[model samples]
Target: MFQESGVMNSEVVGKRRKAELVFQFRSSLYFVTGNLSVNKDMTEENTLV
Candidate 1:
């Protein structure tokens, strides 16, 4: 029973870590895209001027 529980705990931990990594990756991608959009808008405005 103890060994089973230990294995389960490690599985849970691995799943949690993967979820966290994916979340971080998604957030960073969003941030990069947001910055790119902002910069693109600025460039467009400058061209118009």
Candidate 2:
């Protein structure tokens, strides 16, 4: 039925949106972690001298 198809489509769209949001969150986390690590490394080098 047409109604069933519409429901299925909406569900697919919702899933896609959720996946996109999760991916964005994960990417931001990776960026933050990398930045923190770089800063730590720089600080350690400065202290060594």
Candidate 3:
């Protein structure tokens, strides 16, 4: 019983870590795209001025 529970706990931990990594990667990707768009807007405004 103890061994079974330990195995289950490890599986859960591994899944949680994988989920955390995916979330971090997605958020960083979003942030990079957002910054790129903002920079483009700034350049357009400067050109207009």
What would the TM-scores of all predictions be? 0.92, 0.90, 0.90
Q: For residues 1-49, write the lDDT of model 3, one tens digit per residue.
A: 9999999999999999999999999999999999999999999999999
Give the alpha carbon lDDT tens digit for every residue of 1-49 in model 1: 9999999999999999999999999999999999999999999999999
The clash numbers for all candidates, in the given order, read 0, 0, 0
lDDT of 2: 1.00
Q: Could you tell me which residue pairs clash in candidate 3?
A: none
- Best of the two (1, 2) by TM-score: 1
Q: Per-residue alpha-carbon lDDT of model 2 for 4-49, expressed as tens digits? A: 9999999999999999999999999999999999999999999998
- The alpha-carbon lDDT assigned to residue 30 of candidate 1 equals 100
Give the runs in model 3 whose Cα sits over 4 Å from its true position. none
Model 1 lDDT, full chain set: 1.00
CA-lDDT, candidates in order:
1.00, 1.00, 1.00
Backbone clashes in model 1, listed as residue pairs: none
